[model samples]
Target: MGFTNENAGYIAAQTAKRFLDAGYSVRGTVRKLASARPLLEDGLKEYSQAGKFEVVEVPDITVDGAFDEAVKDVTAIAHMASPVSFFFKDPEPVLHAAINGTKTILNSALKAGPQLQTVVYTSSITAVKSAKEPHYVYDESDWNDYAEKEVERLGKDTPGPIIYSASKVAAEKAFWAFREEKKPSFTMTAINPVFVIGPPLIAPKTESAVGETIRLIWTVFSGAPFPLPVNGFNFTVDVRDVAALMLYIASSAAGGPQAIADILRKELPETRGRIAEGNPGKGYNKEYTVPDGEIDINSEKGKALLGGWIPYEKSVVDTAKSFVGLV
Candidate 1:
């Protein structure tokens, strides 16, 4: 279950579809039933006939006990809600929402007790890769030092991206802390995906960080800017793949957070060569640098859960195709 509709992007929608595909009912949280219905309707249209999806209104995720009622009797939760935006005048709000919203859900889940066996959280690659510096190889073991520093020094004047990164780091950290403190019976898994790019379940009208990533490829296809690739943004995974990975983790009775995180780490780069091959050649602007590192996500636990990742080229192609329809 997602925390709120507005925060639930393509990833959340796609993850919900995976659950429905597995013959499970999905109950997503939203601030307003009216606004969220159209999006949910579009995303889960195929499942509507099966009557597997519903929405619960939790207008304020930061409020204590906000998710208490919504989580009751739920077997699993995909906590795919977090405030992310391109424009935030101050970092405090973003930090507060991400950190507090996660705590609120964990608290409610504790109250949920026995029925909640798995809690899957949507974490970002930023949580693992320090965006400030290029690491040769990053894995589930690395927590972004840059983000940790931002969280330590969070104030009114932090940069938007840093704040966003820190929010992710803080939230994930909070989840682990809560898990240790509360020691709930449920299994906790966190899926740390890179800049996810693929055809959205429902197309968005406005540009977002995700939309911009799609546009970057289009910029190359159209030969608009014959310049260089944007710096430090080399990695990406398909939204659908990320969704499927989450589903696999949630469905796996023995799956834990590290196993889930490790699977993606081990498999994403295997598809890296395809990214360059799929590119139109013009898309490879020299300005940006590709990440350097070999992450071995091939643990026995990860292998038991799933296979390889979705091809990067396929994800970019699908994203470009979707962008054409958007404009």
Candidate 2:
């Protein structure tokens, strides 16, 4: 089941379509029918055109019995539903939702037992890399140590944006711990992506994190208020590519959790550059500014395991041009 109608939802729908096209039945779960209408319509349309797609309404993760009904008879599960927010004053909501939501999904999978053969958990690069460190590059092995401290310091006197990095780290640790203890019958994989950018399945008007980022880039290029942060650098990945990888991981016989992480790192740099270049209407400052911190991802393991999922070389420029209505 995928969460809200954002990047994860878009990617999940695309992955479901591929499965449907491949002659497999696909089921998607969302919190509400109203909010999920766009995805439902898109899925229904795809199924109407070709393939089998079904969207089921599931209770919010915060509620009890939410996962019970969602996981019934499912052969595999993609646990991507988690609380995602750009800014937060309280960490409790985000942290509770993320941590508890993961537990709920995993618990459901555990209950499903042998019926669930594969489970893919969507994680973030925030869980792996520290923003405080000046490391030029990072790999899957690195964990973000500075996120919590920064959040605490920034929010010392007042409510501040909850550190997503800290929440991710805690959630991931919980997931691994659950996996080790319960020893579920299914194969588990986690895909950690950096800044995800691509053509929206909906449009530029939608209020999404990626959309907002795109809008910011637009403002920057259009010569609007351009207070570009010089202290933020991150890797990027196309949503389409991420969706393809998720599907591949779901279906691949040889690939597993570690393999997924490896691929992400190996492809990080190329992906980042592509997403940045894909910003449409490019007329902003030409100066390549670096943030106060550096985030590097190494995906060598992914390449080695997945037989080299090469990132498109023109991804950056192409993405920028496409975003700017040039493509």
Q: Which candidate has the highest lDDT of all?
A: 1
* Candidate 2 TM-score versus the reference: 0.72
Worst 10 residues of 2 by lDDT: 248-257
Alpha carbon lDDT at 156, candidate 2: 38
CA lDDT of every candidate: 0.63, 0.55
lDDT of 2 at 179: 84
- Candidate 1 lDDT, tens digit per residue, 174-212? 988988998889999887776666777776555443454
Off by over 4 Å in 2: 1-8, 48-51, 131-136, 149-162, 205-210, 220-230, 247-295, 304-327
Query: Candidate 1: misplaced stretches above 4 Å?
Result: 1-5, 131-135, 151-154, 205-212, 218-223, 247-304
